[model samples]
Each structure stands twice: as structure tokens, then as C-alpha cells.
Target: MARIMSGVQPTGNLHIGNYLGALVNWVRLQDQYEAYFSIVDLHALTGRPEPAALRHAVREVAIGVLASGVDPERATVFVQSHVPQHTELAWVLTCLTPLGDLNRMTQFKDKSQHQPDNINTGLFTYPVLQTADIVLYRADRVPVGEDQEQHLELARETVRRFNHVYGETFPEPQVVKSSAPRVMGLDGESKMSKSRNNEIGLFETADETMLKLRGAKTDPARLRKTDKGTPEVCNIYSYHGFFTGEVQRAAIATGCRSAQLGCVDCKKLLAQNLEVVKGPIRERAAVLREQPRRLEEILAAGAHRARAEAEKTMVLVRERVGLGAPRS
Candidate 1:
């Protein structure tokens, strides 16, 4: 089976945007690929989360991934920091990455602008670490959202550069595009992000999810309950495209355009459907939370498996780059 490498940041409050956009899709790919799903705590460090919060975030993300349908038995689900090779290889790749290349990364620019006061080297060289994460496992494919397509392109570029210099040790990774790629946030303006504070967490209670949905922004044109709103322009309807079946989505679209459904009632319907889909996952996550040792055991075993693969690649990498003991 082809190997796939993918990860989500330990952002603590994971939302439906994560589920409909990536996690659910990851669940479907496990049987088809040798999936390595990671809770990338290291990646989350750019934001400078407190130690206690970071630990909690890591556990929360792991539980969320497990509860959302990523089978630990099928996929090697591990914590990124647990595998030391990721940072080691990132340093090697960082030396090869050009300032110009990193400068052009849109995410780097956006993040810097967002946190100018604390913009550090880690934020600048983030893509290099991401490249290391994928190439360390020699992943054949990487499941990514549209925002990360540029980073994936950069990863492929790094692969080509490494191969040119070291005689083709790593294969260029491919992108496995998500079916529902860019999930808009409750604000209906930007992508659902923890930093943006526009997310409705996947593991939040049904009541909490409903509370968030009730306040979610919809088509501005629909000022009154009787105003005809275009579903194509409505973020709520886009959500329906993900959570609601085709027939229901059609009804929603028709209702919105014809002014048959009030935004309040429409939002209620979405909340009901969203809860139906995500409520069980939240329950499962609750159970997983109670068993902290079980999560630890899972991470430990996953790290062992991941390290075995990583060490093999690193051994070859060391020989190629003359880092480790010289081969006989």
C-alpha cells in the first residue's frame, strides 16, 4: 500500500471545519493507504502555547482524531514531537531552503503579519519542518487542504533539491485533495481557525455547537425572514452541502432562495443535523478522555512504529550526507 503522511496541529478546540474538511476524509483513506496521522504539537509551538495548555491540546487532538474515525489499528497515529527525527531532518532541510523560498510562502507572510511582535525563525522556517515531516517517512501522498497546497508544492521542491544533491533518496510526495477542502468559519469570511475564534469545535457538546451555529453569519442580503437569500452565497448552505444529504441540501437551497425558510429556523435545522453527525464523535472522545493511560499507550506504540520507519530513512540519509559513522 502507498504510504500517506498527514497531521493536524494540536489547536485544542478542534471544530466541525476540521471534521468535514480533513479528519473525516482521513478516516476513509486508512484502508487504502499506510496512513501516518500525527498530532503535530511541534507545529503548534509557533503560537507559543503555555506548557500545560500544549499538553492538553495534544491530548485533545489525539482523542478527537481517534473519535472522528481514524482507526489507530489501521493508521499509525502518533505525536510529532515523540519522533525526534522530524526536528533532526528539519534542520538538514532548513540549510538547503533558500530565504527567498521561505519569504514567498503566503502563510509565513500572513502569520508574520498576525504576530509581528513575536515573529521568530520557527515561523519563517515552518515549511521546511513540514517538508521534513513528509519526506522523513518517504510518504507517497499527503492529504492537504487548499491552504496547504503551496506548502506541499514547496515540499515537492525540497524533494527534488534533495534528490539532485544526494542522488534520489526520497520520492516526490503527491497531494490527496480533500473532497470538501476549504470549510469556511462561522464568520463566513475566513477559514475555520482557532486563532480566528470563528470555529465550532467538533467535540463541543451538542448544545454548545447549536449555540455557535445560532450566531453564525449567513447571507447578509437576507435581512428579514421573508427576504430571498441566495444559498450559493450563504455559508450555512455550504455547510449543508457537507452535513446535509443532497435532497435536504436542495430543500435548503430552494427554501433560502424562495424566502420559505427563516435564517433562525434554517440555522436550527443545520444545528440538528450537525449534532446528529458529530454528537457520537464527541461522546467517544469523552470516553477516550477518561482513559488517559490508553491514549498514552497508543502514542507510545505509534511512536515506536513511526521511529522504526524514520530511523531507516535517516540511516540512509546520514550515509548519503556523511553525517553518521562512515559505512564500511
Candidate 2:
């Protein structure tokens, strides 16, 4: 089986968009591949968060992962910082990465535009660390969305560059495009993100999720319940494609165009379906949150397993680079 590695930044509460777009796929991938998932707290550092808040965010992400159906027993799940080889390899890869390539990264430019004052070196070199995260594990497949295609390309290039200099040290990771639906936020303007305050958190109560869905934006042209609207243009209808069955979605589309279904009732149906799917996950997350020590132990064990693989890779890397003491 191909080795798969991926991670999520512990920035804040993960929304339904995150669950459907990434975490849901991750759970399925774990059963199909040798998967390693991490709470990338290191990446979160670019924002310059408070230390205590960072710690909380890390734990919350881990809990979210567990609640979202990532079985620690099936897949290696840990904190990124727990395996030191990630950063160690990052430093080496950073040395080999071209400054011009880093400068060309679209994400870096976008982030700089967003937070002009705090455009630190760490932010610029984020993709290099991401390259380390993948190559360190010798992962052959990386599941990612369209937004992250550039980063994965960088990772593959980094692998080829390192192999050229260091001699066949890492496998070029390939992109496993997510089959899940691309989820939009309540605002229907941009991706569902915590910073935008448009997310329905994965672990939030069903009622809370329903409230957000009920208020979510639909087709702008549709003014009243009597107006016929295009379901294809509605963000809420896109969500229905994920949570609702095909027959139901067809019904919703027909109802929408016929002015037979009001937006409020349509959203209520979405909430009901979403709850049916997410209710178990919320319950699981609640239990995991309560058992803090169990969560810690799970992470500790995952770290131990990840360290074993990372150390083996590092040994080969060290020998290739001639960085360690000469063998007797």
C-alpha cells in the first residue's frame, strides 16, 4: 500500500467544510492506505498566537480529528512537533530550496497581502516545511484539495532536488485529489474558515449547526418564497449534494425551480440530514474531549510510532549528506 501523509493547521474550530472536504476523506484513506495525520501546530505559529491558545488549539484539533472518524489504531495521528525530524528535515530542505521559488509561491503573496506587517520568514518558508512533512515520512501519496495543488507540486520538486543532491533519498509524493464536495460557508462568499466567522464547527450541537444552515445565503436573485430560483447557483444546494441523497437533491432542485419549496424548509431538510451524519461525530468528540488523558496517550503512542519511521529516514538522510559521525 502507498504511504499517505497529510495534516491540518490547528488554527481554530474546524467547520463542516473541513470535515467534508478533508477529514471525511482522511478517515476513508486510513483504511485504504498507510496514513499519517498530524495536527500541524508548527504551521499555526506563522500567525504569532499566544502560547496557551496554541496549546489549546492543538488539543482541540486532535479531538476534532478523533471525533471526525480518524481511528488512531488504523492511522498514525500525532502532533507535528512531537516528531522532531519534521523540522530537522525542513532545515535541510530549506537550504536546498531556491529563494526565487519561494518568492513565486501564490500563497505567500496572498498571505503577505492579507497581513503585510507580519510577513515573517517562517511564513515565506511554509511550503518547505510542508515538503519536509511529506518527504520525511517518504509518503508516496498526499491527499489534497485544488487549493493545495501548488504546495504538493513544490513537495514533489523538493523530493527530486534532494534526491539529485543527496542520492535517491525521498519519493516524489503524488496528489490524491479529494472526491468530497467543495463546501462553502454561510456567507456564500469564500471558503468556510474560522477567521471569517462563517463556519459551523464539527463538534457543535445539532441545533447550533441547524441555526447556521437556516441562515445561510442562497441564490441572490430569489427574493421571496414564491420566486423560482436556480438550485445550481445556490451554495445551500451544493451542501445538499453532500448531505442529502440523490433522490432528495433531485426533489429539492425541482421544488426550488417550481417555487414549491421555501428556502427555510429547504434549509431545515439540510439541517436534518447534516445532523444525521454529524450527530455521532459530535457525540464521539464530546467523549474524547472529556477523556483528556486518553487523548494525550493516543498522541504519545502515535508520536512513538511516527518517530520510529522518521528516525529510520533520518539515518539514511544523515548518511547521504555525511552529517553524522563516521561509522566505525
Candidate 3:
């Protein structure tokens, strides 16, 4: 099986946007690849989360991953910080990465602008670490959203540079984009992000999910039941595309575009359908929460397996780069 790597930040509850966007697709690939799913706690440090919050975030993310059907046995699921090789390799890649290359990363620019008060070296060197995360595992296929395509390109560039100087030790990683919904936020404005405060969490209880969906925006053109609204233009209808079946989606689309359904009626339908999907996830998360030791055991074992593989890779890397064994 081909090796694949992907990471999720342990910042907050991964919302529906995460589910429909990435986790859903990851579940399908678990059996098809030697997958490594990581709770990227180190990556979350750039934003400077509090210690307690960070720890909680890590557990929550792990729970979410397990609940989402990423089998620990099938795919290596561990916290990124557990594998020190990631940071170690990142330093090597950092040296080869040019300032201009990091400067051009659009995500770096966007995130830096958001945190002008605390823009640190970690933020600037973010992509270098990201490059190491993929190449450290020698992953050939990386599942990415449209937003991360640029960074993936940079990782490929770093591989080319390293091969040019140090000889070919790592393969250039490939992008494996998910076919799920592109972007789904709570407020229906921008990407569903915890920082954006515009996300409906995947693990939210049925009541909580419905509450958030209740006041969610709809076609402004839909002021009343009688008025017609275009489902093609409505954000709520877009959501239906994820949870609703093909037959139901076609029906909703036709009804919405024809103004046969009011915005509230449309949203009510979406909320109901969404609950049906999220109900089981919520139940699974509850079960995981009740067993904290289980989550820890999963992580400990995953870290052990990941460390063994990383150590083997680093041995060859040291030899290829003419570095001797560790000093006593």
C-alpha cells in the first residue's frame, strides 16, 4: 500500500466543515493506504493556545478522529508532537527552504495578517515544518483542500532542492484533493474555522446543532414563504448537498430554486437531516469521553509505531547526508 499522511489541528472541536470536507474522505482511504492521521498539536502552537486548552484540544481531536472511523489499527493515529523526528527533520528542511519561498505561501500571509501582534518565527517557518511532516514519512500522496495546494507545491520544491544537494532520499509528495464540499462555515460567510468563530462542530449534540442551524443565514431573496429563492445560490442548500441523498438533493434543489420552499422550511429540512447524520457521531464521542485511558493508549501505541518507522528513515537519512551516530 502507498504511504499517505494528513494532519488535523488540535485547536477545537473539528466542525461539520471538517467532517464533510476531510474526515469523511479520510475514512474511505483508511483501507486503501498506509495512512497516518495526526493531531498536529505542534502546528497549533503557532497560535499560542494555553497549556490546558492545548491538552484538551489534543484529546478532543483524537476523540473526533476515532469517532469519525479512522481505525487506529488501520491508520497510524497519534499526536504530531509525539514524534520528535517531525521537528528534527523540519530543521533540516528549513535550511534548504528559501526566505522567498516561505514569504510566498498565501496561508502564511493570511494567518500573519490576522495575528499581527504575535507574528513569530514559528509562523514564518510553518511551511518548512509542514514540508517535513509529509517528507518525514516519505508520503507520496497528501490529501489537500484547494487552499493548501500552494504549500504542497512548496513541499515538492523542497524535495527537489534536497535531492539536488543531498541526493534523492524523499519522493515528491502528490496532492489528493477531497471531493466533499469545498467550504462550509457556520455563519455561511468564510471557511469554517474555530478562529473565525464560524463553525458548527461535528460532535455537537443534536439540540446544539439544530440551535446553530436555526438562526443560520439563508437566501435574502427568501423574505417570505411566497417568494422564490434560488437553491443554487443558497448556502443552506449547498449544505444539503452533503447530507441529503441524490434524490432528495435534486428535489430540494428544484423546490428551492422555484421558491416552492421557504428559507425556514429549507433550513428546517437541512437541520433535521443533519441531526440524523451527526447523532451517531455524538454518541461515539460520548463513549470515547467516558474512557480517557483508551484514547491515551491509542496515542501511546501509535507514537511507538510512528517512532520506529521514523527512526528507520532517519538512520538512512543520516548515512545519506554523511552524519554519524548521535554523540555520547
Per-candidate TM equals 0.97, 0.96, 0.96
lDDT of each residue in 1-328, candidate 2, tens digit only: 9999999999888778888878999999999999999899999999888999999999988988998889999999999999999998899899999998888899998878867889999999999999999988999999998778888888888889999997887888988889864567889998888877888788777789878877789999999999999999999998898889999999999999999999999999988898887889888888988999999999999999999999889889888877893254
Query: What would the per-residue lDDT of candidate 1 be over residues 87-129, giving only the tens digit for each residue?
Result: 9899989988889999899999899998888898899999999
- At residue 184, candidate 1 shows an lDDT of 90
Best by lDDT: 1
lDDT of 2: 0.89
Give the winner by TM-score.
1
What clash pairs does model 2 have? none
TM-score pick, better of 1 and 2: 1
Candidate 2 local Cα displacement, residue 99, angstroms: 1.0
Cα lDDT for residue 285, model 2? 82
Worst 10 residues of 1 by lDDT: 319-328
Error of 1 at 152 (Å): 0.8
What lDDT tens digits, residue by residue, belong to model 3 across residues 35-109? 988888999999999999999999988998899888998999989999998998898789889899998888888
lDDT of 3: 0.85
Which residue window of length 10 is worst by lDDT in model 2? 319-328
